[model samples]
Target: MSIGNTFYQHKDIHKKTWRHPDGRVSNEIDYVCIAKRWRSSLLDVKVHRGADVGSDHHLLIAKFRLRLKRLPPTPQRARPFDVMKLKQPTVATQFQLELRNRFQAPADCEEAEDQWTQFRTTLTKSAEAVVGR
Candidate 1:
């Protein structure tokens, strides 16, 4: 929405030649009249610069409220090529234990490397087991 710098007490006439990097806005119509017309939908309004594109106009920013209804997400049907899980399963107590006791970093470089090597081996095996390839 465009507004005369009067109410805002900020004016920059030189910005008339300025242009926004994003194409979200460009020189447009009056902002005030539009805002008052749809005061409920409009959340906020802002003014922007309009560089001379052979048109003498300033850009405007208008915010609007959008209503969306929440719906429960449904599980999508799996495709043959999809690499996700073949079956949806619940997390078990054993899985939680493995995750909690997985690994710890040591102060020494050699100890850390040993732990990291074991971790990588376990990960590779897990991936291979999942796909059964």
Candidate 2:
């Protein structure tokens, strides 16, 4: 078991992390592990013997210098109306009337994609007028 850092250079007091109740047996059981690919990012690792956490194990701290890649923000699209609102009698009637008046049936020569876009725009506009944006 390699502890991932140069543990040999550290003093005996800092090296032995856990102390037995009888104070006879002490060993370095705790460790900080990182992939070899990220070994360059790991700067230093040490055990703080002065910390009194009422535990047998000492506090181990590791310093790292890392650069995280930023991800591109996703494009926000227009949200659809709430389907539950259509269950209400007044809202249902209003929605039907607005959709019927605003949506003109696309011609035979018109593309399916263009017709779908027009339908979506008309529905969203009508829903915004009644159910709000």
Task: Give residue 33's error in model 2 in angstroms.
Answer: 6.3
Give the TM-score comparing model 2 with the true structure, all chains together.
Answer: 0.50
| Residue pairs in candidate 2 whose N, alpha carbon or C atoms collide under 3 angstroms | none
lDDT of 1 by residue, 19-103 (tens): 3457444333443544444445556555555434453455555556866669999998744322344343432333334444654
Tens-digit lDDT track for model 2 on 1-133?
2355454477777667788989999988888878777777777777887898999888887888997779999999868668788899998999889888888877752788988988878888888887764
In model 1, which regions exceed 4 Å deviation? 1-29, 32-38, 50-52, 69-133
| Most accurate candidate by TM-score | 2
lDDT for 13 in candidate 1 is 43
